[model samples]
Target: MKKKKLLLTTALVGTMAFGATIPTSLAHDALGSDVNKGEERIVFSNEDLKTLESSLLKGRKNVGNFYEAAAVQIQELEGVQNNTADVYAHNGYAYLGTHTANGGNGGVRVFDLKDPSNPVEIAVFAHDVPYTWQEKVIVKSVNTPHFKGDLAAVSVQQTSRNNSSRPDSVGGVLLYDVTDPTDPQKLGFYQLDRRITGTHELYLTTQGNRALVLASSPYADYYTHGENEDFQIIDVSDPSNPEKLWGSDPRELEEISEKFNGYHWDAPDGHTRPVFNHSVITDNNGQYAYVSMWDLGTVIFDIQDPENPVYLGRTEYRDDQKGAAHSAALARGGNILIETREVSNPVGDGYEDAYGYTRILDIKDKTNPVLLSEFTTELTYDIPETSQGRTTFAKTVHDPKVHGNTLYLSYYSGGVIMVDITNPNNPTEIGRYTPESANVWGVFVDRNYVLASDMGQGLKVLARGNKVVNNGKGR
Candidate 1:
């Protein structure tokens, strides 16, 4: 267990924004319970309600100095309920994905970003069913198997907080012809069987005339089933027709499951040994797929042969430290792997448990990799006791994006933290923006601006330019 800690500040909670905090009775849980359930749905029982009653706390009070307030938030696209999970931007359009919420149906929100500051809500792709649980969408130009100019893929998780109310809900991926950003056509629907849980996140790629999809099935692992259910691959070259290509080897999955059967998790309740794929990413060439396997560390696979993947290697974690391995990004021509860990609980003065941080690994030699350094910001909390307040400075990483030498991370309650990874061995926090009620889920860095999806707010476009002085100049 090599613990590589960088020079990090244990103070400065970041820019402070004052807002009205919702009461516990009116506040809802984040993504719901993570208890025993094959469908990974949110089930708020009497006990859950009782817990929520006692979890009401105050809002954020202090601000950190390290926070530059440099990343100026230019625009905020509000959704029905604002459970935005991921954002995918194309030529001039931004596709925003949403999770199920109280007053909204989970669906895809498309905006014409022809104007960055003032985006127009041109179209929306949502299911007509009573219960909808869409978490992510990917839009890209393609000349694949069926010659579809532009395509969009959306994920529908079959689980829900109230399972009985979503009887007709099913889990799978939905394909659409988005050649026209304003009007998307339903191309196909690739639904999965009940044997496995719904797809949580998908890694999509295109080569020549073929499109590949590697889905991250969260709860359906080898231990739960007799086969490898975590990393299932599918070929959707033909937009109208999709096919399941292959999945990770069951034998390999079984081996790892047995090895980590006694692995300790970071659950606030107790130690729970479980393995699941939180997300996966492929290199530009689509030669390999890196999986963020929770508690199992990061797993690598050679996917040059999309039909048959070969296990390459994986990173090891200390027994004393729990592995939350949530998401990752590749940098320096895929030589370095930057991974983020998802923390389920809260930390700081009022919380009971702590969480993991961002890690930089030197994978120039995939077989024999080295941990370069680890980065984490100072954790601060306003009301650490309640459900809403506990997330304050819940310094957990949800997703990350790498542009050249800079790494952009969506740090849940920690807001967004940008690190200068020019020197991978000494990654330092360059800039950060923590909204008063920040619960950022995804972040993507573009040419000029960075797009982040917040669980409470929709799409936010931020610029990493000049800092904000008492009376700062635009230039």
Candidate 2:
């Protein structure tokens, strides 16, 4: 076991100040400067943990009342573990990813959703990955020449930044042949370079006869010492032979530096914000990609040719607004884009005392995305002035999933917020569900039911109608 100490201060303490915990093996080191010098490892000190505990306590106080409109929780499954990270619903099943909490070894859990209200855990995949955790899992149906049927892609990240040099460490994408939900067969793994940790987020889609995966490697340049790119496109037509098609480096893009050069308020205490791809998603046709570059805004690229990506444009933030361009989803015939900003620091220099919210953008013109409207919950805007400076994991918006004209947002402590995106310009909250203690990480809207992954809780199945069919017993 090895330990890496981080000398974190105000600026360096963004989302890391939340509930992110490192393994005991990786203890805190106080040998460096007050600010992080691009070290990949994320370790917190006792003081930081105290701050998190205090923040969570204060945040729960403001969790508000339990409310639901046009939606009801039909089923809930406290997963095999407590650190569930994300969930993806497909066909008649749900795949849940886990984080590196409690222990470093965490994997994906698959559930049978035949009975929407009574999901049963059928199989668990990739739990054998040593010293690793999975944050994103996406399963897509492929009909390419090399493969056909349901394919699952799970992102594996090493628990410690320095663990990449160890032989038993796992850091990459693990593919699985989950055509059979009850029994998933291991297909292949697309391991990241040693210098790079692993894929934080990814989007799997099919283009023509080829199946492609757009993997976002956050801060890859800093970890790899500027030798690798942050965004990678891989051709997984054959699950057993996943090949890299191309990579996109945000630092090379002139627009990135040009648009965010003078944005100091969003930067860490005394440091400049680093530009890198935090997450990515493609259009329905898989011809274009929207890469969420933190502080750089959501960058758009033409990926018709997987090998060559053409830069189009990106969304911008006002000088006073904190930019964390976290994750995004397209809606309304691909004309409307919903971008969620994950501002971990509620009150900071030159910024308001508020958590991140959803930003509605009109991307009808690929060259320029115009901000249509901004949506924020009462918790995001009304945090107590007493708890303004602390980091609260409960308030910020994490992920968004759109179905038809509705936007299902997984808001941390705010729970799952259902918004009417029929009119992107004037977005209105049509419904919301906040558990007694909610920490929603990812959300997915399938058919008539919605699946939300809560970090503290587990798999939550909610539907629009009042009568949710429950044939079997809870697992």
Best by TM-score: 2
- Global CA lDDT of candidate 1, please? 0.61
Q: Compared with the true structure, what per-residue lDDT tens digits does model 2 show for residues 1-475? A: 1011211111111121111232221111111110111112222322322233211211111112211211112122233233577889888888888765556455788877777756787777876667777888999999898899899988877766556367677577888899998899988899887556678889999998899988887756555544556788899999899998787654344433312321111232332443567799999999889999777788888888777777778887775676778899999778888999877557655555678899999999877788999998887875665854455556688899888887888887776788887788898887676644567777888875678776655677764433322221111
Best by lDDT: 2
| Per-model root-mean-square deviation over C-alphas | 12.0, 10.8
Error of 2 at 137 (Å): 1.0
Give the alpha carbon lDDT tens digit for every residue of 172-210 in model 1.
Answer: 778888899888888887776544446778877876678
Which regions in candidate 1 have their CA more than 4 angstroms from the true location? 1-82, 161-165, 222-224, 253-272, 346-353, 380-393, 464-475
Worst 10 residues of 2 by lDDT: 1-10
What TM-score does prediction 2 earn? Answer: 0.79
